[model samples]
Target: MSIAQIIGSRHVLAVQNLHASINYYIDQLGFSLVWQIEGWALVQRDSISIMLGECQDDISAHETNNHSYFAYIEVTDIDSLHQEFTHNNVEFVSQLATKDWGQREFAIKTIDGHRIMFGQELLF
Candidate 1:
């Protein structure tokens, strides 16, 4: 028997307001709206897709402390991407820097307080 290959993934996030989250992902974060219903939305940029579900009563990601990080996206051109995010006035959790772990990375916080890290592997 042959093993099945895994393809892709979509990160599901519980947001306070579905409409605002969708707008942030689309307008601020450069993601395109894949689809949206009453209480849910899907947004994507390149290969990264996020599913936002409205959960008004739930605690926001910022309150989770260190546990708030959701995704670490690998990209090709880290500098350009960082510049773009900076230009958009995105709220950054951490500034772009090369780490000893062989990755150049940065992190940002969404309007709903979800955190995502973007990185590019260092070519040593």
Candidate 2:
């Protein structure tokens, strides 16, 4: 029997307001709304998809400290992506920097406080 390979992933996030989070992801982050109904929404950009669920009673991601980090997205053109986010006024947790571990990366915080890191492998 052949083993199946794991495919893609969608990060699920608990947000305080579904509408606002959806707008932020689309307008600021350049994601397109895949679909939305009631308290749930799905947004996508390139190969990344994020599922936003409204949970008013749950703790916000900002309150989770380091646990708030949800995804590390790998991309090819790191510099251009960083510039695009900057122009859109996306709230950044960290600016683009080449790490000693051999990656050029940056992090941003969604309106819901979920953090996502975008990185590209540094070809030394």
Candidate 3:
């Protein structure tokens, strides 16, 4: 694919605590804050950008997640990412392992209970 064929991507997530969520993404995952105001913040790590909005609705994170992942991010080195998050004491839903589809994968629940899976394609 050419550069014009693909654009950037962003994921909007509802977080219960604005400050805490921003801090988690910045400090834990090494994401840099692009901008923040009122109840919204935009953070980025490399080419990926995620928007976190504070939610006041009458719904819990457990209800929001409900056994569903919020997003799937492709990573270059899944093991290094898992190790980095693990070093930060991040809680994981699944330890790193190759899936049945032949991709190395792992899952971690964010502070707001957003489950994000990271994986890399296996050439073999």
Q: Is candidate 1 or 3 superior in lDDT? A: 1
lDDT for each residue of candidate 1 in 13-60, tens digit (9 for 90 to 100):
999989888888887889999898889899999999999999999999
Q: What is candidate 1's CA lDDT for residue 90?
A: 92
TM-score winner, 1 or 3: 1
Q: State which candidate has the highest lDDT.
A: 2
C-alpha local distance difference test of each model: 0.92, 0.94, 0.88
Q: List the residue pairs that clash in candidate 2.
A: none
Q: Compared with the true structure, what per-residue lDDT tens digits does model 3 show for residues 3-54?
A: 5655677998888888999999999988999999999999999988999999
Instruction: Evaluate residue 114 in candidate 1 and report its C-alpha lDDT on the 0 to 100 scale.
Output: 83
Stretches of candidate 3 above 4 Å error? 1-6
The TM-score-based order of candidates, best leading, equals 1, 2, 3
Off by over 4 Å in 2: none
Q: What's the lDDT for residue 101 in model 1?
A: 96
Error of 2 at 48 (Å): 0.7
